[model samples]
Target: MTATDDAAAPPLDVLIAGGGYVGLSLALALKRGAPSLDVAVVDPAPAGAAARDGRASAIASAAREMLTALGVWSTLEPLAQPVEDMIVTDSRTRDPVRPVFLTFAREEGSAAPFAHMVPNGALVAALSDAADRAGVTRIAGSGVTDFETGTAFQRITLADGTTRRARLLVAADGAKSRLRALAGIQTVGWGYGQSGIVVTVKHERPHHGRAEEHFLPAGPFAILPLPDNRSSLVWTESTETADRLVAADPFTFAIELERRFGHHLGAITAEGTPRAYPLGLMIARRFVAPRFALCGDSAHAIHPVAGQGLNLGFKDAAALAESVVEAARLGSDPGSADALSRYERWRRFDTVQMGMVTDGLNRLFSNDSPALRIVRDVGLGLVDRLPGLKRRFIGAAADADPSAPRLLRGEAI
Candidate 1:
């Protein structure tokens, strides 16, 4: 689709505010699921900018399947690194050595690995390309400035002062979504007083697709494998400590990193400038408002302890797409209260459940209480010993929820 001035553009069936992964995927999914529907995405970032974000995500098996069903996974598969095993340990930041308390290997009978570490850029690029091919319009370098919902359609005002209309409006904006706030959606959450320091490190030896999580007093530190003998570090610490570490000189920063990183992989060097983000759990009290719906971080943002945040957003996109498409197929108004309610009902409980799980895990593990530590370690050991239980845990991490939407199950809407 050729770029046209927003003023002259026709009304859209769905107008999504945000061009991140969830927004792009939702647009593509909708177009693919119901070709007759008109969809467009608006974001303040220039076109292709999101594809340059310097981060990676763990795509659970279910999310991978959804991407494959959307015909974008093949494009990303080449750059994706499958996770073959995962090890968990609990220790202090200054511990001489952290002992693994739990380990999960590739489960038998599973066609795909539990998850794949995929660069966010590659995934976004693939989805963007697919959306373009699917004839979805993208309004770049601008965002929804305001909107007025109506019975039949919602009038939208763009940041560039262009007005357009849509049957439904979606907020796939980030956790601090301006659109969501403007829609008067209240959120419930709290800051963990922790921050996640992110960086890519190149190790002398290959990781062989192993991921590790060390539960330190401050939070969990994760080393997720990337392609080319590189691994992404997600080091969690007190907010102040994280800020100080990231701002420290190269030598000091490297020293601190080494203290937590250990020598399991031999010598390591930082691959890029380190960045830190404050940790928090924010869930919108409601996922839908009038003709508007929330997807991705706009609806819920959880701790990265389980590496399921991105996958949760994908689930939201899949479920919302399926709901809207199925409604249209039934000759129902896609933006009707009944249709939006279904999407809300389908996702709210699952999202809440994940939020509670991650929150509880973070609270249980991010501490130095001796009694709590012993209890958690024992729990981890038990889970590791129980093969059936381990498989179930792995399956859950892979987004194998039985009530998953058809799109998430790799089924056509």
Candidate 2:
């Protein structure tokens, strides 16, 4: 439970690399889902310096449900923003082709929300608290400098030169996962010709807890609502254009963004320095290698058009943890090929399908052909008009179902 517990504690059943939201959240989920096992999280941050901030994460309803199962969602509710509705439109077209808007609101009997926007720091803090409560040991300033997968366990050499041997090695690191690379997990994908610029701006008008996707000719111009009438923006543009924009001064940057942003939120002012992340779709050829498994952005990274990138990672985490915990309950080796493959079987199709959908949508909506525009808009409107289809879409977003693993269904795995 304490930082020193990393070395003094007993050998771990799971050792997670990367202390980011995905890794920490997964560790917390595993600890809460299976208390009989010992888990240790190895992150790069220095010990006792836990009050870190400046990062942000968008937690979807599905993620909230998973966190609720881990018993960490209640503490995070205060720092979260609930998304009530979503509006979709074309930025440049005058008539906007076929207008369509979708709302993931609770019509009736729907107890879960659509999504939440939470500060990455707040979520990390909550997870740390939850991990401590679950008696999961923390290993700070200890990232894997080298990792070797043995027949029975994976051996990790940390920055401090201490070795960690675990039955299951989980890679919850970011897009460039060192553990994955060390395991020689080949990834099959390439970078997009674009980059996504993320920023939180203070708008002149209240967002009313609504999310907006202005499908501009270049890419998606999304505005996700925050708590205090502020909104987080994910503006995707060509790689060249994004580079130029981020290098621009705040005044110049806000002016250019305002022009593309229109008068939807009235006058908007930049609240922080804009950061750019290159967009891409990368899927591992295999989700697991021997005694190792991949989770979060380490397993796959996709375009954020649908804002489900992190949500999908959480799904992977929940499913992977569930698979292992369930196997443990059945007196099975959770790290074996069969058990890990079960986790893969549950996620591969869904993850790959989402990648294609988001990638295709990014390409389709970014084109300016008048015919394509009209056809896609009409398709959008059609989907919006079908109530049954709308419910299906909403249900899919929340990931609520019996076939889903108990952990993913808001039940202990």
Candidate 3:
């Protein structure tokens, strides 16, 4: 209930190294699922820092279910925008007409949309509030500087010169996770030579809940609908070009944006400062070692071609929470080899599968070869024409495997 400061604080059942969406969600789920477990989150950011995140993410249906189960969705629902339909197109930057090759629409009988676009700040705030309410300790302005495992627990040294112990040390840190590296977990990945320019735009007309992905020669440029008349752009380009565009004057940047964003939205204006993040594909060689485990981007970082990165992280939290809570309920070591092994087995394949799918998609479409373009366009057209196949694709995007955690199924753990 308070910021942890005592160096001799009793060992926590779970100590998360990052206080982002994944870490906070996992902590909230564990505390709510099993109140007796001692959980604490140590983040390097100062207190109340999550409210400043200027990005938004697509929360898939399964992730929404998990959030709702954790009692955080209600606080975020009013600010979220449900994606009603999506269209994919392949074309060059100056193409007058970008023909839609694939389309996915929300089914009539579905109770919820396939996904919703939520502001990163709002999601984090909601999760943090829920975490606090559930009695999870919040340690801000600090991070795990080093850690070592004993037979029963791990001793963690903090950047603030505090020492704490935990049965499980979860690395929900980002792609360049120091905890992951400190744990001796090697990653297999390479840079994409591209970067995604992320910014929010205010348009003259409403998007009507439609999302668009334009497959340009460099990469996929996504326009995701946000609440009101705003849309979030994940515009991809060569790393060099991306950096230049972000650094350009507003007038010049707007000119380039209008080239990619057509008259369909009438007129558009960038709402805030644009930032570019380099694209890459990274997956830890292993998800667990001794008392440590990886979660979220620490375990896998994929290209944003499919917009499944956040959902994958949410799934990781759900599966890990399920495994740990079940182990705790049985009076077994939640961080025992058996428990960690089960969590790894449940998530590693799914993480690898998503990584490869996004990687292949980026390779197949992020190019200018005429033959490859024709082949990919024809493939997209063929898939679009098959109603049953399209339905399955949509279902797969919204639903999870039958073996998913109870929280992901909108059930109590």
lDDT of each: 0.92, 0.80, 0.93
Best by lDDT: 3
Clashes of each: 0, 0, 0
Candidate 1 lowest-lDDT run of ten: 1-10
What ranking of all candidate models by lDDT puts the best one first? 3, 1, 2
- Poorly placed runs, candidate 3 (over 4 Å): 5-7
Error (Å) of candidate 1 at residue 259 is 0.4
What TM value does model 1 have? 0.98
Residue 201: error of model 3 in Å?
A: 0.4
- Residue-wise C-alpha lDDT for candidate 2, range 1-413, written one tens digit per residue: 64453334455788888777677777877777678877888888775354476545677666787888888888989888887777788647343342445445665765656778887777778877777787877888878888777787777788887787788888887789888888899999988899999988888888878888889888898888888778888999989999999999888897888777667678888787898889999999899889888988998999999888878888888888888887887877767787799989998888999899999999899878889888888877877899999888877666556676666667777
Which sections of candidate 1 miss by over 4 Å?
Answer: 3-10
Return the clash pairs for model 3, or none: none
1-413 in candidate 1: lDDT tens per residue?
64465635666889899999999999999999999998999889988899998889999999988999999999999999999999999999788878888998886776678899999999999999999999998889988889998888899998888798899999998998998999999999999999999999999999999999999888899999999999998989999999999999999999999989999899999978999999999999999988899999999999999999999999999999999998999998778788899999999998899999999999999999999999999999999899999989988888897689887888878
